[model samples]
Target: MAGVRKGGDLEEVEIDLGDASDPEDLDEGEQPETLWKASSDREGESIHSSSLVDISDTKPLINVRDPRGMNDCLKVTFEDVIAEPVSVRSGDRVWIWSHALFEVSRIWVYRIVTVLLAIPMSILSGILFAVLSCIHIWMISPCIKCILIGTRWLQKLWDVVLEVIVRPLLTSAGRCCGGFNIHLAEE
Candidate 1:
């Protein structure tokens, strides 16, 4: 039993699971014994029962193998067991049949994704690539080439300036300090 407060009123909900009833039977006016009942705090008020989501008739998203029930394991036989054609069950409770179902689902997903998402994504990528290529060809490439040429010319000018100005200044300073060698042995 779980209780919740709604608008200052306490409501109690009890889950009935003794009958193990299928949820699909609720729509046919045969309410399953296993249900959730909600009672309000007010007296003489009837219990409110909301139908649980019924998924018994629908196929499950995942494959589950029943160990004790039918289709438990694969049987290896030397002779034919049944002459009648096997009916494919909607829900794959069998482990071996699950592989085929998975492959079928994969194929559908691939087709849908290719149709819905992949085509649009590819078109967007193509448009972006074309725009970038146009920018690179018209604007970016010329700017890059001009920057490279300017950088090379500036480097050459810097080397020439350093040789003309700094080397002569250092040589003149050495001469003015009364020669390049000041030996302790001579002193």
Candidate 2:
């Protein structure tokens, strides 16, 4: 069972590949039967078989060329992007050929552009990141550390000045004014 999305709607397609595992069960020169049945989700629609491709050979139906899965951006093909609902299908071979041309041109253009730009852009990015890292680690970080150490020393000096000079002066002033009293008499 495979789900194919056509124009933002997912339509279910049932694929019948009879007896894939036991090839010896069939007699010589007998090929496995492959059936593609379209089961649409729309109401009152009948199931129909469309021969999309011949997959009688032992090769995989979908060949993934990207072994490392790097080029995920290029995974969108003609079938993925272009599709017609059952009602609006034009049944024109020219449209199909145009679609094939569009897909091939898109893929080739992207590959060529990437081949031209990927290496240079990657090198530039690597150099930029390396420079930024060096500036942060060697220059900015050490400067900040030095400023913090100087700030700690200045804080200790400020605390000592407050305790020694300010506190003594305030205490002496308070002691001198301690005995002063005012009395009011009315005749």
Candidate 3:
């Protein structure tokens, strides 16, 4: 039993699990009965009872056996590919035959294609990735690092040249030009 407050009023909810304390005590195909009851704080209010759903009574529409999830991409069925509204469904026998044919043909075609191409493509892709990784790690990365080190030395030399030579020359030029003045006239 649990108490819940709703809109300033306290409501009580009760869960009843009948008879069996341990789930293992129930026989195969037997489900423990579960009931939910809700009652308000107001006097003379009736308790509302609701029954819990039994999961064993329901079954999945599609049963896919993909242990490693490898066949997830191929789990589409005839019903998934084709569907009609409930009011416009095809005849029962025709739909059943179509489902059987589609599933059988799809499975066989996938097996045949994989047998022909899977191994060769996997080997080719593996070799290609290995070569690309080696080139990037051994050749391109080292070359880029060498270039970066050389640029750092060149940058220091450039800064020294700018400060020692260019700065003095620009300062002398500015001093020489400081004394000269030109007048602008309109003709």
Candidate 4:
């Protein structure tokens, strides 16, 4: 109790690491209780804000040669707040575990796109059917019937061959090969 105080608050935590001349010289009273300790008031205190008191008359953040180290952490920021950010769903749908499966506009736009693409494609198909019928035909009546049946048969054969040979090796091998062996490829 020669230099120890009873009521005065601890203004600074003095770390005398280099003062230990011998390992046996460290008595029970001389050793600190904790291995690593820091004042809680250093929270959010910028290193540039505090200045030196001796030369500059302020508590400056100096890069000491003895304790040469620095620690930094990752900081994620959105808009203005400094904390965890929330991801907003931009669609009207049921979001399940960060994934929205029942998208309203997704299916709607898909249907709309299919209809849009189908309109032009179906019109072209119809025109192609008419033009093919007109080819290699002298008689109008019989030729029209033949063209209709021929076109239908050709389309069926093409669909079969495409599904069996082309599609099995290309787009949908699983579905194409599944019903192909039983001669049930939508004749």
Candidate 5:
């Protein structure tokens, strides 16, 4: 879709093409000529104009005289322009620039609205996220670290208790139960 905006106020227009005959059945080297019609609303009334032209022909549609092998369909020669602004009023008839036409006012409106809302909303969300992150780092992080340090100290105390008290008791019990047989005899 294409749009032409002149000032702060945006005016939208649309073009709708009716079902036309397909040119696929034509034989090789044959091009199909189509009756093209274009219409617009003027003062709440329909105004239409039509022309007979070959729709399937791929030859340059804009320039018919140039033989320089430039097949560009939209080659503009500045010489063709009048260089003066032609006065056109609302409801006045205007010629269609090309055979093809399109419009996208609704999509354009949605896009602009999304962009407008996104800027402020993103800033607010970013500020909220930063505040939460600071709280987690400054307040919650030190508390978690202290808990981790306490757990490590407890683990070291448990190891020391096991080594000093439990290991000797287990060894003496094993000796009394004949678990180890070591004897010295002077024979």
Candidate 6:
């Protein structure tokens, strides 16, 4: 799925090329060979104006010979940022990326949200932990265990909020990323 921001909406466009092994399949032996079509043409119309030489056989798409529109962009990939999380056991690597997610962030807004949310959540969670600990020591094992279980739900809610709220704002206002933010210069 590719994320595209068109007309003020950040959309996830799925280009499911089940097997793009051959471009020939796309051309009914007669794919439109125009550089661009008439702007006035109705949607889905094959006819277009302006033509470019047939270099389709050489490459599936054209290189960015022009960067008239692209400015201030970042890219992210799965293997680089989240994969190979630090090991839990010393000298033992655990490839536990079962829930790995990447996100693009604007420096200012993301930092502000982090500061606002982190301090309160951390303090509240710490207090909850301490209270739960005391409860457990007082033989209230089930109640303490319940709060421990609730933590996982809170984690999931945080994940959803980040995706639904944070990602959209950042992509539209901060970066040109759909889900993940721009990649750093150094891994």
Top-lDDT structure, candidate number: 2
- Comparing 1 with 3 on TM-score, the higher-scoring candidate is 3
Q: Across residues 1-187, which tens digit of lDDT does each residue of candidate 1 receive?
A: 3444456666566576555466764667675653445556466454443445333332243335454568645452322331234574444355346555666776788788889998889999999999999999999999999998879978898899889998899889888886556657754
Q: Which sequence of candidate numbers ranks them by lDDT, best first?
A: 2, 3, 1, 5, 6, 4
Q: Which candidate wins on TM-score?
A: 3
- lDDT of each residue in 31-150, candidate 4, tens digit only: 533322333233443323333223221224453423434422322122233223357543334334223333445567778998889889989999998887776354677878888887
Pull out the clashing pairs in model 6: 37-48, 103-180, 103-181, 104-180, 104-181
lDDT of 3 by residue, 93-176 (tens): 988988899889999998999999999999999999999999999999999999989799888999999999999999999999
Off by over 4 Å in 1: 1-93, 157-187
Q: Against the unseen true structure, what C-alpha lDDT does each candidate score?
A: 0.64, 0.75, 0.74, 0.52, 0.58, 0.54
lDDT of 6 by residue, 84-158 (tens): 445543332233333232333345567889899999999999999999888777767777777879798898999
Where does candidate 5 stray beyond 4 Å? 1-106, 155-187
Ordered by TM-score, highest first, the candidates read 3, 2, 1, 5, 6, 4
Question: Per model, how many backbone clashes are there?
Answer: 0, 0, 0, 6, 0, 5
Candidate 6 Cα RMSD (Å):
29.8
The deviation in Å at residue 80 for candidate 6 is 9.9
Tens digit per residue, CA lDDT, model 5, 85-111: 556433223223211121244456668
> TM-scores of all models?
0.34, 0.38, 0.42, 0.20, 0.27, 0.21
TM match of model 5 to true structure: 0.27
Lowest summed lDDT window (length 10), candidate 1: 76-85
Q: Tens digits of per-residue lDDT for model 2 on 80-119?
A: 8888897887758977897979888998998999999999
